[model samples]
Target: MLFKNIVTIAASAAIASAEDVYLTVKSDDSSINGNVLGFPHEGAGLNYFFLGTGSATAFTYDESAKEISYPFAGSYTQFFTVFDNFVAFSVASANTEITFEDNVLALNGSTSNFYACKDTNDPYSYSTRSYELMWYASDAPSGCLPLTLVNSGSAAASSSALPSSTSASSAAPSASTYEGSAVKYAPAGAAALLAGAAAALI
Candidate 1:
């Protein structure tokens, strides 16, 4: 019974500590400005792309750990991961911390590697092709869209001009596809509960 109580407290604390926020981007090109980050479909391992339209994906941002995750996915292992400059969802432990400051998203406190490259085909059929998320060290390939990751709320408040491109009507990925992922964090609440649990054990 004591063990079960401790586990319950720990889980509850984690849930309580998570903050809900949207991952949105902006750029000089109005065509993709104010776009949200999303995946094409529901799958365990899938790459995240940019959607020109539709509601943005709400992610759990653990301010303490500087990690972003989708806790609604039902599995805590799914995290926004980067490999060889490409971004995707994976169960592997995240190696870097992600944070948003001054209305820009930063990785390990730097905001240099994020880029959006156009895909070969339009999968969502919204007439606008989806942009694959990637990280570039120095120069991005020709035609790739440069972007700044920002908090959705901040983006909306600061955005004065609406996208004039026809692609603004592009559909975003369905919410069902956001399942099976989460960000990991060591919440202070959980730590306090653990200390109390230890005292009880003693």
Candidate 2:
């Protein structure tokens, strides 16, 4: 069933605070998907990409099978690949007020991208970019959703795609495809389980 258009929990408190950011990818074609995650590394800054094999932390994707694995979960981008020759999206973590200059709009705003990735392995190349994303949690409207989220600004700087020179000889990821599914940092019942574990340990 199509999910009801409801407010995500991320925007529940403080009304205008910018925290807990989440992203989802939708395209005209049903064969593609993109997944993203934000983790707080020892340092700070937002950096995520499929081409950055240089770092050890960015989420890993099996391009040949079109599968993605997130380390620490929340509302995250999932299963991204070369569905398009290149994919481009922008992230501004200044927590500055959202504005037209940011090219931001409602949740249904325009997200567009076109990429000429000379390297089929990494999509971080400036050449392989298309898509305009404006995270609006900073200035969302009343009744906005409050989902468990992590925005680009809060993302760790260590996140990056594997450098193309490094060959991740995994099965080629499934042909660029998309499957949109909201992930939770923890399942609903896990909270109680955790509390019980804590009590036992204590």
Off by over 4 Å in 1: 1-17, 41-44, 72-76, 119-128, 154-202
Q: How accurate is candidate 1 locally (lDDT)?
A: 0.54
> Per-residue CA lDDT of candidate 1, range 1-202, in tens?
9999999998888777777776666777886676655554222333345444434566667777677765322233456767666676554567778877785778877786777786424333311345666778777878887888777752232344533222121111224222111111111222332233232122
Cα lDDT listed for each candidate: 0.54, 0.24
Q: Please report how far candidate 2 places residue 84 from its true position, in Å.
A: 18
How does candidate 2 score on lDDT?
0.24
Worst lDDT 10-window in candidate 1:
179-188
Q: How well does each candidate superpose onto the true structure, as a TM-score?
A: 0.63, 0.23
Model 2 misses residue 168 by how many Å?
15
